[model samples]
Target: MGTVLLAAGVLLWSAAHLFKRLQPAKRAELGDTGRLYATVAIFASILLMVLGYRWADPVWLWPRAGWMIHLNNLLVFVAFYMFAVSGLKTSLARRIRHPQLTGFKAWAVAHLLVAGSVQGVILFGGLLAWAVVSVIVINRANRDWTRPPEAAIWREGVALVAAVFLMLVVGIIHGWVGPWPFGGGA
Candidate 1:
């Protein structure tokens, strides 16, 4: 049942996201209202996926090592930093065309490394494929790309600091929900 819910959630979320890419003309016809509806669907599907994942029985594929945990932690921190960079008006943001997507890919890969269960693979692997496809589609859609204006160094520094703080907060939240990111059992 949990696996079924997870698959349904992934399908729903993917369909909601890909609809725009598949039918830009239709999406444009609906405009902001359509975008809002899609957003709602995506969030709802994600909630379902999370709940399903939590309830699912584990079908482990491999033994997780301490090193894998350390690598996952490092990747997660970098992913958060990339996400922060995406939001800030920084030189890094200007240089990196898809910081958010890159961060998401890293996050998915990190989870995939540690989450050896069948459900975990389905969730993270599915998301990873989605992110990759989204990036490809977006790049193809936008043929000509112009560079953004550069931001101040101070602003970039602040964003980096905020990223570090956010990473710590995320680690704490991870511990609260399940496994502690630092290798300590929750």
Candidate 2:
């Protein structure tokens, strides 16, 4: 049941995110109401995934090494920084067309490396594929893009602060619900 819910959540997440790109005409027809529906779907998807992961039994396949945890931590931090780059228009923002999606990919890969269970692979790997597909769809829809101007040095500092804050908040939540993330653990 938990695995089923997890799969459902991943499907819902992918479908909801791709609806705009996949069915632009239909999305346009829905107008403002689509935003509301999308918000609900995304929230529900997240909820289902969380609950399913918590309830599901782990079938560990490839066990994570101790050093992988450190690497995961570093990649996770980079992912957060890249996420910030999307909004802050930092250095990499100009080079990367989809900073947010790239960050999502980094996050998924980091989790997959540390995750030993089949369900973990399904969850993170599914998300990774979704992000890749989203990029491809977006590229297909619009081939042209304008590179934004470089942000001021001050914005980099601001972006770093935001990333740190987000990491701290997520770290606290992870510690509360699961294992501690700061120490030598995954």
Candidate 3:
């Protein structure tokens, strides 16, 4: 049952993002409703995935080998860098509105290196697929890649703060937070 829910959540989450590129005029007319539905689907899917994982039985296959863990850390570091630069006003984000999504994919892929389970695969795999597809869609839809230089010191500052916060969270989760539904100490 838990596995089923996790898979369902991933499917729903992917579907919402996949359809986000449908007719611009229609999407505009749908307005907040469309946004709301997308938000709801994303949130609900995530919630369901979490709950399913919490309730599911674990079946770990690969041990968190030293190299895998190191890779995870490396990818996470890159994720933070991508996330930070994407929000900077240095004409970086103009090329990508989905740095956050890229970060998510990195995070998921990194985790998969250490975690091997049906639930883990579904959650991370779904998110990874969504990130890739969304990025492609956005890249295709974008017309003007050029823009005047814009700088927001505050935005950069906030991104730094967020990066620090996320680093701390990762440390806690990976080092202190128990493996819980998984095993072998998180």
Candidate 4:
């Protein structure tokens, strides 16, 4: 059930992005509605997965030690920083227009290292695969890899702050919420 929900989330998420590239006209037609549906789909999928997780029994396949979770968290922290930078008009985005995608890959990789359950594979593993494929597809479709614009220093500063905020949030969740997706208690 968790795996199904995870796959559904991935498929919905991928379809949402792929549609924009493959059928821009259709996407424009729906406009905000399209976005709304995509958002709903994503939320629904995640909600279903959460329920499945709570209901199903855990089966650790290749669990990593809790100590190594710190490494995974660090990697995810870097990815979170990249994700923040990618949203801004920083040189990072210009150089890597797909910083979010790359960050997603990094995040997925980090999670994969710590998560070895069937649920983990379906969620993080699927996301990792999607991120890699999406990056390649986006690059091929754009055919333009121009350098990104340099945002104001203040904007960069804001991004840095946001990254730090995200890291704190992740840390809190990992420590207090009991990392079910990835083994907790380090």
Query: Who wins the lDDT comparison?
Result: 2
Summarize candidate 2's per-residue lDDT along 1-186 as a digit string, tens digits: 888888889999999999999999999999999988999999999988888887789989898888888888778887899889898998778899999999899999999988879889879999999999999999999999988898788877887898899989998898888887777545
Instruction: Score each candidate by Cα lDDT.
Output: 0.88, 0.89, 0.73, 0.74
Of the pair 2 and 3, which is ahead by lDDT? 2
Best-fitting candidate, scored by TM-score: 2
Model 3 segments more than 4 A misplaced:
90-98, 147-162, 173-186
lDDT of 4 by residue, 50-137 (tens): 6655555567889687766777877787798788888776656666677787788888888888777777777788778878877777
lDDT of 3 by residue, 21-122 (tens): 846777678899989988999899888877777777877766666677678777876687668867664345655566778788898898788777767787
The better candidate by TM-score, 1 or 4, is 1
TM-score of candidate 1 to 2 decimals = 0.94
Deviation (Å) of 161 in candidate 1: 0.9
For all predictions, the C-alpha RMSD in Å is 1.4, 1.4, 3.8, 2.9
Worst 10 residues of 1 by lDDT: 177-186
The candidate with the higher TM-score, 1 or 2, is 2
Candidate 2 C-alpha RMSD relative to the actual structure: 1.4
What stretches of model 2 exceed 4 Å from their correct place?
A: none
